[model samples]
Target: MVLRLNIDQIEPATRDWICKVQIVEIGRPRESLDKKCTFQNLILEDEQECQIRAVMYTDEIEQYVSTLKLFNTYLISTAKVKVSLTSYGKPIHRFYWILDKETVIEEIKPSDEVEKPLSPPNKLTITSFDRIPHLMVDSTAEIDVLAVVLHCGPQKTAGRSHHKCREITLCDNQQNQFLFTLWEDFGEIEGHEIYSKMATQRDLLVILGRSIGISTYQGLSLQTRYNSTVRVNPNYPQAVALLNWAKQNKTMLLSSPSDTTSTSSSITPMIVTPSGQQLLSIADISSAASMGVFCVNAEMAILDEFQDFCVLECSGCKQKKRTKDRKDFHCPKCNRKTSLVPRCSFQIDLIDNTATTTASISAELGEKLLSMTAEDIFDITCTKRQSLSLNPVHEMLSTKVFDIQLRKSSWTSSNTTTTTLSILSYMEKQHPPQSTTDRTSKKIKPLEISEVEVMPTTAAAAPSNAVGKLQPPTPTKKV
Candidate 1:
């Protein structure tokens, strides 16, 4: 008989010991940049409910990846134990195991005791939204949060690889709203479920983000890291409290002043994004304009080296499409047959003598200004995997002044409303300067070469193969 060990008892010094563990969660298989290595992690919990991470790689991945079932108790032995390089955003265990060919995995008999099945960790503590900022100060720290689902964004493919990504907003008891990104499997599976349910059961669901990774980049947002956990409507007690809190504050949670008004919204509050186009300076931008479009002259720069400038949007509802396969999918929100089309939507900053302001540019106007359609840009950036940031045409366009048509807009965050501007259209404030290559464009010939010669005659009889060719109506004679 072999000696058995608990997960917490296994260490590097332990030898020839078997551990009975139930697979709690299976992580997504990850591939190396070179494609030479592939690996996945299985979170295992022992009888004491202590957890550890076990990894399987390459050929071993092909052999047993499908054989293992979640929450199934198995006896694992002879796996290599190693110290964890980084502990943040992973299992609490200080060590992890690497399974190899010598490893033996056998299912435990049904009559024997199984530690637990489908049970979330008991130690998870929900952090209040107010403290999220404090956690951000330590990038290495992981956070657990419980919040109500407020809004869901359409799925978007990023980079040339088209890695799937989706964004959703959540609200907490403090009424703070924050954007969280669901990536990889979270985006493909859970994101769609949340979005579909949102149509009918909008305010009912509360989410628990366990071991979530935080980012301070554009703003504070939550994201999923490798082996991160996200549970929707989990049976946790906090889920109940958050759901009740959400229902009680449903009025405040779902209210949007921008939704009620068109063209412009009043200065009245909670992130005002006036739909009207206006401008002057980014810093001076405020609801005081309650105005129409305005112009500004500024040196422009494409802040991002490369990014998706457009997304597939439903023609009917105008919401972003979240499906991975865009060829054929229905928009559940509109409950109608709809097709996806490229929409012109991107942000850029313009700096004038006074201040620099970032603004949004829409389709028809942006296409005219850039001389490149949204569809073409999407193909180049996301399909062809090319960077437009350094293109000569874009560089030259940035050198010219812009007649920016601004629109007022507002965004609600942390329960506060602030006004912002968007661009309805933009064009060169002055005629574009002549290029050196166009020097001979306006030169005229010395001869009377401008006159055109007109040559026309009745066409010959059509060939047998030209059956569908028009006969020009035989030039019908007057009555």
Candidate 2:
């Protein structure tokens, strides 16, 4: 029998080495842009608990698709070991494996005759909730999370594709709260469960497996990817500790009402504005200047002339066209001719007795304020296409008192400082959120609010509308 080696000891020169490892993760089979090639990735771990990513091309993937199952131990040999070019490989080891047709794989079957092999390593990397803010700088590093579920927003449809999404507020031991989103099926299944639980249970413990951090303008947030898993109140020491912490701070966690957010692009991403949303005085907002997000009770102090009230955005990527005309007939960014969607683009002055700032409004809340969809409004403005017109929004909001959520960002240059505030959502005092929640749950209708304008999580000289991610998304997989 050949001696087995740990993942750390295997190198490019170790041609004769064999590894008795368990498959911890199995990435979906991905095809190239041209659909000319296909590949699947696997994360393998040995007895020492060291992990490394192993990839299989179309040929090898088909050969072992059934032979290699998750949690099954196998004897692997003759796979090439190469240095990883990315830091996102969940690494203490720098090398990744590539198994070709020549590589040997043998599933170690269970037997009564011999002693049982070591159990498969769970391969969980539980990241502290506080550390998530710092970890946002590395988008590719997927982290497991143990968080207390404070609130669950009603699952709603969003985006041009009308994807189903749900947002939940998660609290860590440090008392720091952040939003986590469940997309598509995860939202339908787990989101429905949590929303149902909130009716009875005050706090719920959730264990997330392999969640990606989205450092949006809303600060550090989390979302489920295609490979991510959601486990509710699993039996574990870390989760038990988190449960104890949640029980201690139930009131504080649920004090401030929020709608929550989705995507990595939005910050102050709280979309849930309580129906009875209480407005805070401008004086009250100024005192909590250190906070990244603020929901103030303010009125339309001023409304700017609606110059570009609506901009045409690429339906595929949801980015505005950069052409000089700003309304190019077709999207240049997409590989093919993609459709354009009309989104609300305007600004209004929000004011209280103590302070004031210009808050930009786009899509989401802008629709509610105007009482019209962006598309319908866009068509009306396009006939004769007036450049600047009397802003109609002022008249509607001038007399109305609304609860507005704003994200504050500042920049300093040439010894001069400028601050920008953008409105995230608005709430009518008479209209309660629970009523809206019940309607959407039965209808499952989606809302489209693609464009997000806010600064990074950290304070910097960057403009208010500019959003920064740890790394630009990879053009190919978008994984």
Candidate 3:
């Protein structure tokens, strides 16, 4: 008998266990130091979502990794579990399962019972922007949101990794404006196609099964995950209703103040960190300016080495300082002789599967994460080494994972829209909190909704404890 172990239940100490999981995403194969490994993000569900990351070392499990298909369920056993090694890989769970030589893998036959729940959900039960506050913090609760496409940014590679992303600004009937970020292949073509029609006519965009979360800087934004689907101008009843509502509210959305007015104001400022410290992809930093400061757990080696990773900054305003006499320093922002602090103003480029972005760490925080003072890095860079050895900064940051506290700062005026990240604090160790389901299941007051937004009289009378199940998709006439 195959022992079905949930992804969340698998820990570093667990061994010789069986896990039935669907391969949700396959990362590009990476070759490092004469060894190749591929990372796969898997999902295990038993009436609830449980996600985890698994790695296949090339020497032991290369053949199995190549034959695995995305969205296909497999029963895997004899796998090794270890504390997650890399943070920049954007691990889905706190711990990662490793497939070694002894692992056994088999594909399960698809069946009616399995197919019904496993398929991508087609019907979208729309959630209003005002109800965003009710969304459980730091948890990936499936949500459907409908809005009119206002703007779509060009798609670009995010970090040093294989992640790609695009930005979309949307508005709803209630003059609620939101920022939806598309990662990887989600809405890649649809965003561009909608961009062309945005100026010509009103276009309704439906984001189904998108992960909704609140951030510290950009407030609430829609994030696309591996299972999320995006459709433009679909011929559904909800889409038609939203289209009409958008048409009625076009004038209000246009006249509203872009800088001050935001849909996030209706929601509270509390954003729980999912996977600890709201583990965000590199691509999320650009649109997270309004969400406030958040934390990301990333591997130390994910960043590239450069000289400017360490520099001098003014202690008063935390801005870069300019020196005329090498002793006296002047800050451009303060424009006064300020005491220049030798700090690490490291511009580290971080890459993950979703996207890539550069993060600038403060000297004090950089020293803590790297375990090396700015002066130590300066000495190593300034003085030539006779033998081959890694730089002091690289030696410390190259192979470790850290939970980094990042706050959004200014951005460069370049076309790429580079966002600056100020590191507040960092720790080399991470302790996984209770599972999301356990945390979210805790008692919280229900949100009050108006009559119009409530369900129909018949459905509203259904059992209070009933969980809504997805109905099979029906054929509908194209709009």
On lDDT, the candidate that comes out on top is: 2
Candidate order by lDDT, highest to lowest?
Answer: 2, 1, 3
301-365: candidate 3 lDDT, tens digit per residue: 42334334455545554444443122556655456775754554454544344444555554344
Off by over 4 Å in 2: 1-3, 87-93, 112-115, 127-133, 138-342, 348-356, 365-479
Comparing 1 with 2 on lDDT, the higher-scoring candidate is 2
Give the TM-score of each candidate.
0.48, 0.51, 0.35
What are the clashing pairs of model 2? 157-446, 217-267, 218-267, 218-268, 258-272, 259-271, 259-272, 260-272, 275-433, 280-297
lDDT of each: 0.58, 0.59, 0.48
| lDDT winner between candidates 2 and 3 | 2
Q: For candidate 1, what is the lDDT?
A: 0.58
lDDT of 2 by residue, 241-303 (tens): 667777776776656434323221232234443232245665555444343455676666333
Backbone clash tally (model 2) = 10
Better of 2 and 3 by TM-score: 2
Minimum summed lDDT over a 10-residue window in model 3 is located at: 455-464
